[model samples]
Target chain A: MSWLLTLLAPILGGFLYGIERKLTARMQSRKGPPILQPFFDLFKLADKRPMVVHSYHAFMGIIHFVAAWVALSVLFFGGDLLVAIFFHLLSTSLLIVAGYSVKSTYSRLGATRELIAIAALEPILILTAISFYLHTGSFEVSKILTAPTSIFTSVLGFLALLIALPGLLKKSPFDAAEAHQEIVGGVEIEFSGFFYDTVYAAKWLDMLFVFTLVFLFGGSSFVVGGALAVFAFFVVLLADNSTARVRYCDMVRLLYSLAFVLAGANIILGVVL
Target chain B: MKKTIHIPIGSQHISLLEPVRFSFECENETIIKVEADVGYVHRGVELACTTKFKFKQVGYVVARVCGLCAIVHSTCYTLGIEELMGIEVPKRASYLRLIANELDRIHSHLLCLSHTAENAGYEALFMRIMKDRELVMEVQEAMTGNRIQFDYVSIGGVNKDMNSELEGVIRNKLGLLHQKVAEIKELFDNNWSLSLKYKNVGVITKEMAYRSSLLGPIARASGVNFDVRNDSDYLPYSELGFKSITMEGGDIHSRNMVRLFELFESIRLIETALDGMPEGEIAAKVRGTPEGESYMRVEAPRGECFYYLKASKGQYLDRVRIKTPTFGSVPGMIEALKGSNYADVPAIIASFDPCLSCTAR
Candidate 1:
């Protein structure tokens, strides 16, 4: 059952992306694309003529997708949460490298912001894991799932993760890295055709990975996990709709002063109380 | 490695509405120097106005200059032709012209405000404003029988007349628009995220505005009280109670506030005009060809739109020169870009509301 879920992760991610698009459109007071739009986009991107800037750049995109999928697989198969987090980090790092490999200024600027965003976000995820470890007495997802959980015990961690989620998903107020008007999709600018499809699919995997992390906060109860994920999803969507993207420096300042501090406090509380 | 990095935006960019290029020399995210290249959409409009179209037909031709301010272009050109032909447009026609121009101003300002929001990455606000702008659009369509290129203005007077029923329609639509604009104004004033992107981000002082000869909302935001409507008797704006809106700070936020407040003023003017629209023939008789040079100016939605017409009593004019507001405001735009963050470039450009099609044409 775990392996089957692992295999279906990308498909689930696609649906999640589709749903986000539809929800965003509704918030903006317009009739959005169909729920299957992401899949349609994938097929359309796949059908385009493949264009690569260089062998290294093209290769990095494929590796990025694989790393993201592997990260999801680790979580699904109940592997070490730390390993999964690191793999997720690796996936973004690879894309950053690909962005740097190009001559396009927008791509490089995007990659730079993406780097800053992860810097602000990664510590919160790590703290969440540490909080989980304190509760379950293990970092292994397999062990954590078997243990009963309540979000209230690590409520600060959950809130911190909520703060980080918009940055993770590239939503507004935290979406400077992918500000299409300013940087033209940033690191994603140079990618085209099947290469872009790979990057696009990787983004879907990222959605699942983040939401799955939220679900894990619910521990043993899939219903509770699903509910938590849904709740966080709406919060992120609201944030995206109601705010404009901040400057990259402002984003870093906010995530650190607010979110990182909260996450650190959660870890300290977990260790003490 | 160099200390400064060069970035070019435009000629073709996602954020830009028109094809004017801007090259920025930056140290990190701070823009240290700016170079702008305008006139990409040049269609030889002046030449075409002289050679291809007759004096009577040239209003329509110049109306094609910029779709957003189409009526203003035609109005200015028509006024110029009328002055040369010694045609006194009916007082009723002037009142109708004022209403159409104000409606045009409301829609254009909303478009600029929405675009500025979008460039700042507030897509939802952008969408909301665009949806609201449709109110003005419906009113425009009802008034002029067209949505955008309302060739409502002609040589002697307007092409369409207002009736009691149409006056009711105008009042109703603009009434709804007033409420929506108030909500939007509140957002522009109070929204924290919008304030971050807008407040003092692209500041141009009153000195800079006056020195650069900036016009429209861009100038008004800097406290420069120079409005063509207040200075000229081209239309019945004085009788209709039109007052220019201004705000201090000269930043993107101030410009937005100026536009939002101006929308209220525009709505008020239209309402006032409708309440007391003088009854007469919308169109007047055109007797002779335009013989002498007559220069005319109209306050376009962007700013002052000037038309210099030299005719020799023939079908075609000898010379036609159009100076659009965007063309005049380019220097002010460049001035605002310098010393700002690179991330704010798109917002600054959008805030200037530079109509490149009008500039280049």
Candidate 2:
């Protein structure tokens, strides 16, 4: 089952993204692209001529995808939560390195912004893992899955994760790193052909990883986990549609002051009660 | 040992609709110096107006200068010829012209708003505004017999007349568009994240607007109070009770609010013109060739669209000069960009609503 899920995560993530595109289109009063559009785009990208700035940049793309898949598999097999989180972080850092390795200004700018975003978001993710450890008294995902609802006691921690989701997903109000209008495609500006496909698939895997974190809070009920993930997905879509992209500085200020405080409070409560 | 880095945007960029280029000198993410090149779309339409086309056919030639404001170009050029020939357009023609002009304004403003939203990463709002803008485009096609390059304005008057069926279509679509505009205005006013992106970003003061001689919405957003529609008598704007809209902040949000308010005002003007339209001939008879020089200015969707015509009472004119609003506002745009974050470059450029074709022509 874990092997099957490991193989299926990217395909399923693409389908979810396709559905998101469709929903966004309907909300905007237009008939959106077909649901299989992401797959079509990926295949089209695969057929293009491969271009790279350097050997390391090309290698890093493959490494990033592999690391993301490893992170997903760890979650699927119910391995240690901290290990999966660290692998996820590794995947992102590899992509940032790829971005920085390119001499293009857009790529450098995008890499810097991504670094800042990771700085803002990584702490909350670590805190989320800590809260889970506090709840089940174990770092193992399998143990947490068998435990009763963590939401009842760790509601504040869940809220913090929910607030951080947009930044993690790089949706609007927090999508400053890839602001297509400002820096063009930013980190992805220098990528093309098969190299781009790897980066694109890695994005899908990352989305799956974050939503899975949301699912972890459901604790023994698949229905609650699925519901929470769906709810968060819709909220992110609504936000992406209605708001403008905030500056990177404002984004950091918001995550630290609000989301960090929520997670810190939740951790303090778990220690006390 | 310099800390500033140069970032080039455009010539070919995803955010830019036209092929204009800008080179920004940045320290960290803050822009320290800005340089703009706006000659990419120049097709020498001014030269074509005087050489390739006769005085009577120059109206259609000038209309090709910019697709977004095609009607304003034709109208301004035709009005200039009318002034030279002393041809008096009928009341009904003026009213029809007014309606077409405002409809053009509605669609242009909506396009600018949609573009600004898209640049801000609000893709849904961009699509929504574009979907609604189709309502006005349909009305325009019905009245002018074309969607984009409508040869609606001729030397003496308008080419097509609005019928009762077209009138009904215009009214129904305008009503729907009014409600949608209201919703969009509310969204712009209340959405917190949108406010964060727009409220203090790319600020241009009233003093800067004056020094730059900014016209249209960019100027109006900065409290400049200079709209060609209110300041000139080239059209029946005074008769139609036109009131120019202005805002205080001169930021992206202020510019958007100014556009929204002007949209409502345009709808009201169109409705009034339709209700009070008199029955008369659409076109007046043209006599001799334009003998003397005449200068005409009309309020285009962007700002003042100026045309200077010098005729020698012959088939061809000696000169035809066009000074577009975007050209006038480029300095103001550069002023707004200085000291702003590099991330806000696209948003600030969109807010100024720079029409490159208009400028380059």
Candidate 3:
């Protein structure tokens, strides 16, 4: 069952992305595209002839998607939280390299911002994992699930994760890395055809990956996990709608001063009491 | 040591409404040098006005210079010809012209505001403003025949007539639009994150605005206090109680606020004009052909739109020259972009509300 679910992560992520688009449009008072728009996009993208830039650039995109899938699989197979994080980081790193591999200025700029975003966000993910370890007495997801716990015990950590979700998902106010209006989808501008499909699928996978981290807050209870996931999803959607994209410097400053501080405080509290 | 990179926002870019190109020299996302190209959209409309169209038909021809400010173009052209031909425009026609011009300004401002929001990554706010803009659009369609390219102005007078029923429709829609725009104003004024993107991001100081000869909302935001309506007697704006809105911040936020306040002002002007409309003909008979040169300037939504016409009592005019707001404001736009982060480029450009169709006409 775990294997089946882990293999189906991309499909689940695709639907989640489609729902997010629909919800964003409805909030914007627009009759948005259908819920299956992402899938439709995927089909259309896959059908295009692959316009290969360079061998390394195209290879990196496929590897990036594979690495993201592996990261999700590692978590779903009841693996260590730290290893899952490592694979996730690797996926992003590959995409960043692919961005740098291109000569496109927008792609390079997007990569630079994406690197900055990762620097701003990776610390919180590690801290959240450490907070989990401190609470559960184990870094293993399988052990953490069976261990008796609820979201109430680590409310601060939960809040910290919730705050960082927008950055992770590249929503408004923190979406400088992928700001379509300015950099024209940033790193994704240089990608096209089947290679682009891999990158797009990887984005949905990244969404699933981050939400899975949010799901960890539920800890052994399916109801609490699902509810947290749904709530966190809406919170992210609202933040995306109501705010303008901040400058990259402001994004880093805010993530550090707010989400970073909360995550660090949660860790400190875990150690103290 | 400094490492500067070149980035180009081009003639076919996604964010641009018209074809324009900006080549920027950046040192790690801070623009240091800028080169702009605004001529890609030129359709030889000036030359066409002289060669392809007669003096009477030139008003409609110039209207095609820009769809957003079509009335302003036609009005400027017609007023110049009227001055040259010595035609007395009816008071009711002048009032009706004022209302159509103000309505055009309202819709254009709303579009700029919505685009500024979109460029800031606030898609929801963009959509909200666009939805509210439908109110002004409805009133505009009723006033003129079309929604966008409303060909209401002619060589002698306006083509549309104002009635009691139309007046009621305009009043009801503007009232609803006022409330919706107020909510939007509240959001823009108080939304902290939006302020971060808009406030002080694309600043053009008063000195810079003056030095660069900035016009319209961009100039008003910098406290230039130069509105063509206040300077000219072409549109009967004084009788309509016209007042130009200005802000001192001179940033994207200030420009947006100026536009919002101007929306309220435009609504008031339209309502007042409707109330005091004279009971006369909507248009006057076309008299003799235009002779000699006359210059006419009108306050377009973006800024002052100037038209120069020279006629020799012939069917075709001798020459026609158009100066649009966007052309005058480009220097100020470059100045604002010099030291700002590249991320703010779209928002800043949108705030200027560059109408390239007019610029490159």
Candidate 4:
């Protein structure tokens, strides 16, 4: 079952993304593309000739995908939460490395922006893992899953995670890293063909990883977990649709001032109350 | 010595709709110097107007200068030719021309708003505004027989007349569009993230606007209070009770507000023109060749679109000079870009609503 889930994460993530596109389209009063559009896009990308600036840049794309898949499997197999988080961080770091290796200004700018974003977001993620440890007295996902409803006790931390979700998913209001209009695809500006396919699939895997983290908050009930994930997905979509992207400085300030404080308060409350 | 990094935005870029390029000299993220190229879309329309096309045919040729404001191009050219021939367009034809021009303004303004939102990364707002803009498009099609590139204006007068069926359609669609536009305005005014991207970003002060000789909403946003619609009698603008909208901030937010208020004002003008439209010949009789020189200006959606025609009692004109709003405002755009963060470049460009097609032509 764990192996099957690990294999199915990307497909499931793609379907969810399709739904997101459709929902966004409906909100905009237009008929969106079909649900299988992401798969079609992946298949089309796979058929193109691979091009790369350097061996390292090309290699990093594959490594990024592999790391993301590893992170997804770790989450599915109920491994250590910290290990899964670290692997997820590694995945993004590899993409950043790839971005920086290119001489293109857009790629470098995108890589720098991604680094800043991860700096703001990764701390909150660590605090989330810590909050989970405090709630369950363990770092293992299995232990957290079997524990009582973590959200009930760690509501503040959950809220913090919710605030950080857009950054994790690279949605609008926190999507300066991929500001399409300003930087023209940013980190992905240099990627094409099969290498582009890997980066794109890795994005799906990353979405799965973060939403799965949202699922863990529900603790012991699949229904609650699924419900929480759906709600968060809707909120993110709404935000992506309605708001504009903020500057990197503003993004860092928001994550630190709002999400960091909330997570820190949650940890204090867990220790005291 | 501090070394400056150079960043080129386009001849081809996602943010830009036309083929204009800007190279920015930057220290860290702040732009220190800016250079723009606005000649990519030139097709020698001015030369064609004199050598290839006659005065009547030139109206249609110049209309191709910019698709977004095709009616204004045709109308301006036709007005110049009509003045050269000493022809007086009927009051009813003027009213019809006003309706078409204002409809074009509504759609063009909506397109700019949607584009600005998209550049700011508000994809849903972009789509929503575009969807709403279709209502105005439908009205244009119903009245003029084409959504864009209508060629509704001719040398002596308008080419089409409004019927009762078209009138009903215009009123109904305009009513729906007005409500939709109002909702969008509310969102633009109150949305926090949007305000963050727009307010106080890419500011062009009144001094900067004046010094650069900026026109259109970019100037109006800076409290310049200059609109060709009010300044010229090319059409029946004053009789239609036209009021120019201006704001004080001179930032992206103010530009957007100026456009929104102008949209409302356009809707009102169209509705009034429709109500008070008189019955007369759509086109006047033309017999003699145009002999004199004439300069005509129209309040295009972007700004003042000026056309200077010099004819010498012949089929072809001696000269046809076009001064597009975007061309006049290029210096102002460069001035606005200097001292702003590179991240704000797309938003600032979109705010200016630069129509490179018109500029290059």
C-alpha TM-scores of all predictions: 0.99, 0.98, 0.99, 0.98
Which residue pairs show collisions in model 2?
Answer: none
State the lDDT at A53 in candidate 2: 78
Residue range B1-361, candidate 3, lDDT tens digits: 5499899997777778888999999988999999999998879998999998888888888888898999999999889999999999988889889999999999999999999999888988988999999988899899898998899998678887878999999999999999999999999999999988988888999999989888999999999999999999998998877888889999999999999999999989988887788898989998788899998899999999998889898999999999999999898888999999888898998899998988999
DockQ scores for all predicted structures: 0.87, 0.81, 0.87, 0.86
| Residues A37-145, model 2: lDDT tens digits | 9999999999999987788899999999999999989999999999999999999999999999988989999999999999999999999999999999998999989
- Candidate 3 per-residue lDDT, tens place, A1-273, comes to 779988898899999999899888889877888989999999999999888889999999999999999999988989999999999999999999999999999999999999999999999999999999998998898887877664776788889888889989999878999998989998888889999999999999999999988888888887788889999999999998889889899989988999999989898988998
lDDT of 1 by residue, B79-169 (tens): 8888898998998899888888989998999999999999999999999999999988998999899999999998788887878898888
After superposition, which runs of candidate 2 have C-alpha atoms over 4 Å from their true positions?
none
Candidate 2 chain A least-lDDT 10 residues: A177-186
Q: Give the better candidate number (1 or 4) by TM-score.
A: 1
Better of 1 and 2 by DockQ: 1
> For each candidate, what is the lDDT?
0.91, 0.91, 0.91, 0.91
Candidate 4 clash pair list = none
Question: What docking grade does candidate 2 earn?
Answer: high
- Please identify which of the two predictions, 3 or 4, would achieve the higher lDDT against the true structure: 4
lDDT of 2: 0.91
